[model samples]
Target chain A: MKINLKVWRQKNNKAKGELKDYKVDHVSPDMSFLEMFDVLNEDLITKGDDPIAFDHDCREGICGSCSMHINGRPHGPLAGVTTCQLHMRSFKDGDTIVVEPWRAGAFPVNKDLSVDRSAFDRIIAAGGFISVNTGNAQDANNLPIGKEAADEAFMSAACIGCGACVAACKNASAMLFVSAKVSQLSLLPQGQPEAKMRVMAMVNQMDAEGFGSCTNTGACSAECPKGIDLSNIARMNREFFSANLTGK
Target chain B: MNWISTFLKSSIGKKLLMGLTGLFLCTFLIVHLSGNLQLLKHDGGLAFNTYAVFMTTNPLIKFVSYGLYAIILFHAFWGLYLVMENKKARPVQYASYNGNANSNWSSRWMGVLGTIILAFLILHMWNFWAQYKFGTTPYTQYERNLATGKVTFSPFTGEIAGKMEKFVDTERNVEITQVKDLYAIVADGFKAWWLVIIYVISMAALSFHLVHGFSSAFQTLGVNHKKYNALIKNIGVWLFGIIIPILFAIMPIYFLLLN
Candidate 1:
């Protein structure tokens, strides 16, 4: 198959970037989207041209690192899948695919399609943790978490910190991402000690990092490579409200 | 009010504000809608006007009414600040970004719909509040005692309206109702097609704002657990998307169609 790629290129965060078009032939329909890009990179190296740079660590959709606004969506026109997991079969021969970095105030381009997602890291560092002492794991009977509570905790824990949620948000909000982190940690006994302060601190860090407020568009879930639900956001709200109301 | 406190600028802080204010506004909608419901009655209903005047005149009621204004200003301004910051941070714009309008119109047009609602609010006050506060209603000659030559006003004829039910309800734990000529003002204002058209647009804008506002409010407040998040959105659709339009549409529809 032959395909046209318009890729975003930037030398660094401070540099101005634009889309440069490249044409590829002999692309396999069965190839992963990233693999097709690998073919392009090979051609770039052979021709002494700088290859397109995008983020992808674990190609398995769990890591949100393969974050990009592919063809106007968080992950290329496909729903509920990440860029790395996408296949060339979704498109036809001679198709023109546009690729760009996640465009948000909190996320800036680091190279080509790779944006600095350290803002999310900063938010996590600001709070997203349990204050439990490091040791052999506590006895499971120390805390009898109900099945419902345990399930909810696991569900919230599913957030991959991928910038896909932010890319997917209409307001460029990190709320779904932040809320998931808060909800997951806040639900468990290990996270109970500093739950209030943790939620507050992480949320403060998220805002300070310049992420927009979540306006509940739920695009984050739809575009999510992992099907993280929007309910984590609501739980975060309940948690945050309780935190503010009573240290009692 | 620590200027740089994490609570004030924190993401959760912002969400709390959004949630608290969103909840307040939601309550206000019920009140406003209920008042409008009275418009379904004949002569566009005196029950609505009697309540408006009672609210503005009563001391405690007036205090709460002022609080409602403050909430509106805070929500609008804070939202603007966040939106402007987001604009500065974004790098690329899509050729066609309508990928997510399916969720809610309010979510999509936060700024535009909010502005429309604000404009409608200003016009509403100017047309109704100003008249009730300062303008003189014509004192009417009523059915009177012929022998005594004294006036006896008729309630149904719009000569002398009774107090709103809420004000007089023993179950209500308040001193006064804001109801007054505001109800009459509301009725007379909607009687004008142009004014009714503006009112309808504003209601539509409110619905749009609400659709997104309701959902966004939850997200901001950190309501992102998978089990309950969809519930909030579903409720948002029913509340903002369906109910609000019904309430707003009913008034204009009644005036235009029935009147």
Candidate 2:
């Protein structure tokens, strides 16, 4: 299948970007979106031009390293799948695809279809973990956590920190990502001691990163590859409210 | 004090304020719409006129009206501020953005919808509230037979009197009440085709705004749960979005075409 591409290109974060068009002929229907880009880059390199630079690590879709705003959606048109999981079969032959980096003040464009998502790292570093000792692995039943709580915590823990939520949100809000992190830890027995501090610090870090606030549009969750629920955000709001109310 | 200030400055706290103010305005809409529904009563504007007088003069409602005005201003300006900050969060927009892929147009265009509603509010207040309080609102007198419960009304074109006056005619077993005819102003205002069109269009915008705003307020306040989300969404869409706005739009249409 032949395809038309309008890909964003930038020299660096300080440089301006523009959509540069390229045509890829003889594309396979089974080729992943990133692999299709790889083929495009191969062609560009053969012509002595700069190959398009994008982020991709685990081609199997778990690393969350692949960040592409393809065809006006993060990770393309398909729901609950990363860019690496999106195949060319999703598009028609001779279709024109627009690929751009995740657009957010916190996630600056690094190059063509690549962005710096270290802001998420900073937010996580604020308080996304517990301070348990690492002497040995504890017994699975030692904690005696309820099944419902375990399931909910696992769901929140499924966030890949892909920055797709920010890309999808009109406000570029990181509430989904932040709330996922807050929920994953706050729902666990090990996460109860510093719950107040964790919520406050992580939220403060998120605000300091200059991300927009949540307007409850549900766009982020709709575009989320992991199907991260918006209820995590509501949970975070409850946590923050109770934390502040207790003056902790 | 310091923590409170810091909390309010945070993103979630800002949204909490938006939600609180938004839900308050939602309640005000219910009250305003219910009261305005009196416009459809076929009592020669007597019932509506009496309601207008009561709404303006009742002391508790008067105080609540002040609070309502303050809340509206805060909601509008604070919402504008949030929109501006949201714009700043993304300095460069995507060259090709199809927000409809992930979210509804109503959710994405809330700021624009809200601005339209604000503009409509100004026009609405000027047309009815200002005219009722200080403008040349006419007066009408209604006489009712105490025994039969039959009532009749006519224009009271005599000298200026208080907002309302009541007297009993024992000989004829009738009661008389005179009131400022604010309903006449409303009926006349809706008589203009352009005004009715604007009213209907503004209510359309209000419907879209509330469809997102209602359940969104609940989510912001941490009320989102699997068991209750569907119920909340249904009420938001049907009650606030469809019913209230349609009922409101019908008023102008009813006055223009039916009354």
Candidate 3:
């Protein structure tokens, strides 16, 4: 298959960016989107041109490092899948794919498609963890959490912090990401100790990080590669509301 | 003080304001629509005029009306703040943006839809609410004898003409006092095809706005439950989205076509 690619190119965060076009021929149908990018990079390197700089690791989609907006969608057109998992066959032989980075004030573009997602790290660091001291590994059944609570907690924990929710949100809100962290901790018994404090601190940090407010558009969860639910945001809202209503 | 400001300034806090205000406004819409539907009565606007007179004259309702006005302004301004903040959050635009793939069309175009509704609101208030309140138009006070069942329309030219607070409890009498005749104003307003078109278009935009906003405001306030989320969404999409807007739209069309 022959493909036309319009890839965004930028020198640095402060530099002006533009879409530069390239064509790749004889692309295999089964090749992953990143692999196809690899082919393009190889061709660019062979021609002594600057290769496209995109973040990717462990191409199996678990790392959450492969961050690129392929054809105006985060992680391409497939639902609940990463860009690294999107195969070339999703496009036709003569398709033109326009790729860009996550456009958000919090996640500034570092290079072509690599963005600085340190803001998410900072939000998590604000209160995304429990502050309990651990002596050793506890027994698995010691907690004895209900199946419903345990499953919901696990689902909330599935967020890989990919920033796709932010990328896909019209407001560029990190609510889905922040809420997932907030919900994951607030649902567990171990997390109950500082639940109120955790929600308040995390939400404050999310606002301080220059991210937009959630409008409940549900785009974040829809474009989320890991299928993180929007209910986590609602849970976080409940947590924050309760934390504020009652003293923490 | 610090906590209050902080909570109010936080993302979820701002959302809470938007949600609470939105829900309040949604309730106002249903009430407004039901009252407005009285324009369809065949009794020569008697029901609608009487209802309008009751609404504007009652003391408790007057206080609530002031709150309703404040809520409307609050909702609009707060929404503007959110929209501006979101725009700044994504200062750099995507070269080839496609917002529809991930979100509903109404969700993405809410700001636009809201702007349209705001424009319509300004025009509507100017035509009816402001004139009804402040305009020096003459009003005919209707006094009906409760036992005799005879109704009289007299030009109520006095301090009480403007503020008909005394007649708030006179439900038994068929005394028809012509206030600003808002029903005539609305019926006449719809006669102009362009004005009707504007209203129908605005209602359409409002419908789309409500479709996303009705459920979205609750979601922002974290009103999500496995059992009830679906129910709220259905009501938002069907009742507020389809029924209310369509009913509101039908008023103008009915007056235009029938009256």
Candidate 4:
């Protein structure tokens, strides 16, 4: 199959970017989206053209590094999956795919289709974990958590920090990303000690990062590759309200 | 003192303010719609005129009216601020854009819907609320007996034969209810087809605004419960979005055609 690509190109973070056109031929229907791009990159390199730049790791969708806004969606056309997981078959022959980076003040363009997501890292560092004493690992059965609570915690923990939620949001809000981390720890007993401080600090950092507020459009969860529930955001709100009310 | 500034400055806090003011407005919509719906009553506007007078003159409601005005202004300005900030967040535009795949049309275009509703509100207030509050209105008085609960009014009688002060009901006794002819104002306004059309279109815009804004406010405030979240979302879509707007639309139509 033949595909026409309109991809964003920039020299670096300081440079202005524009959509540059390219054509790729003889693509396999079974090729992953990134693999299809790899073929195009190979063609560009051989022709002595500056190769396009994008971020990817583990091309299997787990790394959360393959960030691209394809056809105005984060992670391509498919829902509940990452761009790396999106296959070429999702597009038809002669389709002109538009590719761009995650556009947000918080996530500045590092190059073509790659933005600095270290904002997420700083938010996590603010208060994303428990500060329990270091010791040998405990048995999985030692905690004896209820099934429902354990399952919810595990589900919240599924977020891979992809920043797709921010990219997909009209407001470019990072509430989904922050909520996932806040929900994951707040649901478990081990995550209880620092629950109050965790929400306050994380939310403060998220605000400091200049990310937009969550309007509960559900687009973040709908586009989330791991299907991270929007309930996590609600949980974060509950945590923040109580913490501030009690002066925690 | 520090917490107040932090809450005001923080993104979530700003959203919380939006939610609180939004819910307050939702409550106002229900009450306002209920009062307005009384225009359809066939009692020669007696019931509606009475209710309108009560709403306008009650001391408590008057105080609450001031708060209501403040909240409406706050909600509008705060929402504008958020929209401007979101626009600044994305400096570049997509070459080819299609957002319908992941989100609903109303969710994506809330800012537009809100602006339309705001425009409609200004026109509506100028036509109805401002006229009611400050404009000269036609008024009439009825005669009543304090002891017998008997009331009397006549289109023929220009003035009462007896002193109206003697019939005053200080403690649950019968008395005349002096009210503005607001019913006539509304009934007269609906006679215009263009005004009716504009009202119907505005109600439609309001419906779309409530569709996303209702549940979104709750979510912004973190009022989520596992079991009740779905129910809250459904109410936001169905009750506030569809039912209330339809009920409001019925008023002008009823006045124009039936009344």
lDDT of each: 0.73, 0.93, 0.87, 0.85
In terms of lDDT, which candidate is stronger, 3 or 4? 3
| TM-score-better candidate, 1 vs 2 | 2
lDDT of 4 by residue, A1-248 (tens): 99999999998999988999999999999999999999999999999998888999998878899999999899988878898899999999999999999988899999898899999999999999898767998888988899999899999999999999999888889999999999999999999989999999999999888888877778888889999988899889888878887754
TM-score, cand. 3 = 0.93
Q: Which portions of model 3 show Cα errors greater than 4 Å?
A: B136-180
Model 1 lDDT per residue over B15-71, tens place: 567677977888888887776677675532344555555666698978988999999
The local lDDT score (0 to 100) that residue A29 gets in candidate 1 is: 91
What lDDT does candidate 4 reach at residue B69?
A: 88
When summed lDDT is taken over every stretch of 10 residues in candidate 1 chain A, the lowest stretch is A239-248
RMSD of 3: 3.1
lDDT for each residue of candidate 3 in B1-259, tens digit (9 for 90 to 100): 7778878888888889989999999999999999988888765565677788889889999999999989988888888878998899999988776788878999988888888988899998997888777875445466656678666555556555353433422676555454556666777778888888988899999999999999998888888888998999899999999999999999889989975
| Cα lDDT tens digits for candidate 3, A170-236 | 8999999999999888889989988999899888888888999898788899999989998999989
Of 2 and 4, the candidate ranking higher by DockQ = 2
Fnat per candidate, as a fraction, reads 0.61, 0.79, 0.86, 0.68
**Candidate 3 iRMS, in Å?**
0.8
Docking class of 1: acceptable
Docking quality (DockQ) for each candidate: 0.44, 0.87, 0.83, 0.67
